[model samples]
Target: MTLSPVPDRALAELGRTEGGPDTLALLVRDQDTRRLLMLRAVLDAAEGADARVCSADARARVREDWALLAEADRVAPAGGGAAADRGSAFPGDLAADPASASARDTARDTAAGPTANPAATAPPGGPTPDPAAIAAAAGRAPDQATTSAGYIPPHPPLSPARARLLHPLVGPWARRCLRELGAAAGPPTAEGTRELAHDLAHFSALAAVAAARAGISYAVRLPARDGALVLPSLGVLRTAVPGGVPVDVVHRRGRLTLRQSGVADITVRLESGTGAWSAAPAWTPAYALPGLLSGAGPMPLDDLDPYRTARGGPRHHALSGPTTLDDAGRKRWLHSWSAAAAALGLGGEQRVGEAVALLRCLVPLADPPGSAGGGRGGGSCSGTRREAFGAVLSSTPPTPATFAATLVHELQHTKLAALSDMLTLHHAGPQERYFAPWRPDPRPYDGLLQGAYSHLALADFFQRCALTATRPAHRESAWTLHARYQEQVGAVLPTLVGSGDLTARGRRFVDQMVAVHERLEEHPPPRGQAARARAYVAAARALWAGRRIRPTG
Candidate 1:
């Protein structure tokens, strides 16, 4: 069965509550334009919410068209005549039939001298055809792009909104190259102009996909909201995109076309065939639409074989350490990510900041439960220097919550890895192994710090989930989970502080953590759950003590 990341049933569950994802339900009856505006307000309210996932340009464009539609509906011509020409720009009343739309575009390109932007057209309230969807419609599986040797579209054509959103981030460079290349030729040739338009559209699509996958946020500079817009340097872009081929520019007549021979299929169209920008446009914006990548749902783990040793990522020493999952395993893994994203308020921040990509290639462990993989249960890895990140599940997690927590745990590591690169956390301390509550063996001080911080983050996650949980049991369980993590950090925090191995900077960082922990502890977990948390901590320590403390003569 095809798994939906957020099914109607899941939304129904959220709608039962008064807050968080609950707000989405209220938007159901409103027009898509108004729905988008209302949703933006919610995304803006949350601190550190990744609003980049929604395209402001798309929203603005759609809003304008929506206004026009309202006007048309209000003053339908005397005979209830046809509305004004909406064109194929914004999907709504204006959406033309596919064959006719295609014919119009060709005619427009031929007659309009190609200066006009070939706006992506889609049906109202439907998903815009992305490459994957288009390819699927064409009888090719979405994975064909990866498995096949030749270029296949990376993703369906980005929606007009997404295209506009990504333009500012990468557009200037593309425009500059197009201008320079096109300048090489004489002025005003229809054929050349069309090529330039094609190149612009193609390059725009390529850049959009790259930006989405890279997970970098571009804080667009706006009046009254001047923040840093982080653009990827050429060097960074090389590492972030596949094949990393520099976009080759070619001049024809009076226009320039981008040659992406190796990276994408030349013949593929970048517009959605569904005619709708999204099946659930209003909900998607509030939920951070970009976070919902197409074709990312469940697939057999073995299908990832092509990417196991794929070029153009962080170089790993080992190719195969974990076993590949069968169909059942893939379903479980897919469900876990979907459930976690839904349960936790991770939509805005799903791929923001430190996350580059949500890695899914799993290598199962041969050793039997709990005792296998050197006593390590499931472990995840990410390259410290690059944005290559993913998890390695040694075994299926007992619950979706467990899998979700693991994802958060590993993401914390990536955050730290990125932070460590910017600021030195510790001095060159002695290479001495210290206690890590999770593992049986002693870890270095650095390792201990990462573990402790991750647990602290775990505590934070559960704490937040508890705040929004409607069910009494879920809330209590969340509190209990938080307490357990809080207790784990409490045990390890002191050793880290007293180790006398920390640099001044490291000490300050640790101090901040301690302060946060103290404040969090003040809001104690639900009564019985607190005691249960303490007991759980005690039990974990006893297990560790027995395993680590032997006759060390």
Candidate 2:
């Protein structure tokens, strides 16, 4: 799929950290487009894998399921219509009538291109077609070129939950399995092949899960993770036994059931028009952030997925170890969230709305060591990753104001991450070479850029607080913070503009940032606050310089 270039206006607005909701939506859509391309690549590799990697039956099932899903996606109404009525007639049921199924397959294949074999379409219960043929009909070729109009409508838009499943965490796993299957020098051992097969099957099961959640009526076997059947964005069904279980998921007439032999069946009732789920006691519901503002719906808390963090790596926010929130912890977070939402509403509704919209999930982190009951002084830190779009890993903030500031700061990072994906901001270079006023250790250009951009938002946020704050102490604190970040951002923008590493677009982007910093200067901090902020900046730079080690040739 070809990515359309971001318009100049959109880039400028984003550079100002003021893209708001509409521009953010465009960035999100681009990420989804990239995900679709990645999905196609995974499918192509799976189709080309050695036949010995998976059993013939497993291969046939995956292919047939994929074809049926493609057909359903084609016929589903635009904008996802009514939840109960949308894609209600399961494509699997088409197997009963070969003629109808064949016709549907032919239509899908015809739309894909000349590479698709219309005659090789697989009906659910009929003889399975060649895996390659099935792939050709359902998946876009990696080399295929198409305009936006032709590409987007042929496939279904990913739900937020489904998109999370296809994140960067899964990419390496899929690549590893593909490498094992494609090894030509020596065939893998039988045990290794079987393991690879199981791993690859997870992708197919993900497709099945997506279909089930789209209100499609169907019964299919899905592999479980850690003895639990996870329904993305919904809930999990934990079996009594350990290891992965092959669970049968059946969704019919607004009711979904999970069944595994020797385990109690779990049932979930899907709300008629809303697509919300009401599950049995055995099902562990996923945590979802409540809709705190009008027209801003709930977002997943994302604590359940094993892939929530990068595999075998340190947690993103090191100050607080990453862990799932307990019942008490969750209650605390919700209470803080309520206060935070109220604070944000008073701060600026539009800004908070846009920031919240870009956030897909909030992964909770444990409070820092030596902090009692996760007190406010524990020092909260939030982080965003380039590969994990829309996810924010953060420790719970101590105050409503701190929470508001954290959201704005992280939103800046999230926006920049998305922008970097679409456009080249700076060329890669050596690390720990540039000074960042916010950090003790020297940073690379990219880190410096992220810091400068986020600090820009923090300065803007504190400026707003200073103007609106009613309490004298609150106003004074806001002024000091506003002045501090203002000085930091002012110091960094010129360095970025002259870095010699930024692309033309990057230079333009930084110029927009400069404009914002200059505007903030019009209302300078109070005399005492400015003096304190300048002294603080000088001390920080001295400390960083003292810590830096000069290299000897």
Candidate 3:
């Protein structure tokens, strides 16, 4: 009990690192646009040297490169439909909508842009428009469009609702990431800043391509210092942009802003020293759904819409219709767990947040205490995979202590789902489901392990709650819960060890879980409490056994 809390080994692995190999891709949308924001390293050797070049030379080379590309391909004009087909966003830009595209469609076919579609490049009728002819038609001097640094282009106004949704999806990450990129820029700094800006511009163009597919214009407004360099880079990037949406890059006075059609602007500004971050983005159903893709966060009860998107897989249990807890139940559950989260500190509670955000959807299952307090596991359904995660909960947890422990337990299952995505921990084993203390039906090895792993965390949470508890009753409850979970989880561990379902990696992962649990087991409650805990676990196991053993007669 005296040992200070150790960071959950699993969470340390799951935490985000700047530009890690993991997919940081997110689906962003507004009333008129839906685009996938993806992380790509575009600061390759071609642009790397530019960082070392003089500012004037860096600026010139960027402009020249942009001009060539601009000449080769024409930018698509804005305004398209909101709901786009799913496949249009990924792997590459959506093919230009042949229906409404102007004469430029012919030019797109002949253009030399790397991402230009040769299949659709030819314009209708006359040969593809030459750059000079196209330039003349648009009434510009033959040289090309401006790549002027610090130029702020006019943009369509953003809706307040769209702004709220889009900001959370990209703003925070953008500021932090761009700041990091700026800091990494070497001294003389001019060259590096320009290169960094150029990369940002490229990303912005890609964002625009996605927005275009959703039938909207896109623009990324950056801070003054960073935007100065990035603005010039946009000229070059504009040409390279795959033909699709019309996207512009601009640097404004303050935060980083992403402006798309019908959505309010998303602005991200990370201040120095203070560590003050922008207000967390407000949540909306459309905006919130993507969070489920990551499977973590506090999803609003009303936001759970099953029929919204086809991307996600089904949950084993169906989502109940409009599950809104009464105000009393809401206040009680929220207050209890919020306190528990503070007690658990960031490390203990982070897994819960991750689970909420990733699952992004909650179905209120509300089981009474004796029967089952609901279940924890990644999925409950079959068919097309969903970019969502689901968790079922009892209408009211029997006690605050029970509520807190359940939070940790379910999050552990959610965290495991995320880990499963990152690492292949087990091989398929015999489908013969075995008895698990927590579940009514038999479970395969994976289910058994999930239960064991989650309860290990639950046990740890209760154990800590017991130690830090201020009141005698709370202390007693904590110890009792702690013992019960530890006993149940420990019993299941032996089964998991022998299940023979583990791959090499799965074995190692389970070993770590066992190691942590054994360490906690080293500290036991008073003999009376220990006995009660044992009985509690035994009762649950007995319940399951009786149900399973009952004759089919």
Quote each prediction's TM-score. Answer: 0.42, 0.76, 0.45
Model 2 alpha-carbon miss at residue 24, Å = 2.5
Candidate 2 wrongly placed segments (more than 4 Å): 20-22, 50-65, 68-205, 271-281, 317-321, 339-342, 345-350, 374-377, 428-430, 550-553
lDDT of 2 by residue, 320-365 (tens): 5567677766655655554444454433454555655566677776
Q: Look at candidate 3 and tell me the lDDT of residue 63.
A: 36
Give model 1's TM-score versus the native structure.
Answer: 0.42
Error of 3 at 497 (Å): 0.9
Which has the better lDDT: candidate 1, or candidate 2?
2
Q: Model 1: which ten-residue window has the lowest total lDDT? A: 281-290
The candidate that wins on TM-score is 2
- Lowest lDDT 10-residue stretch of candidate 2: 130-139
Against the hidden true structure, what lDDT does model 1 obtain? 0.38
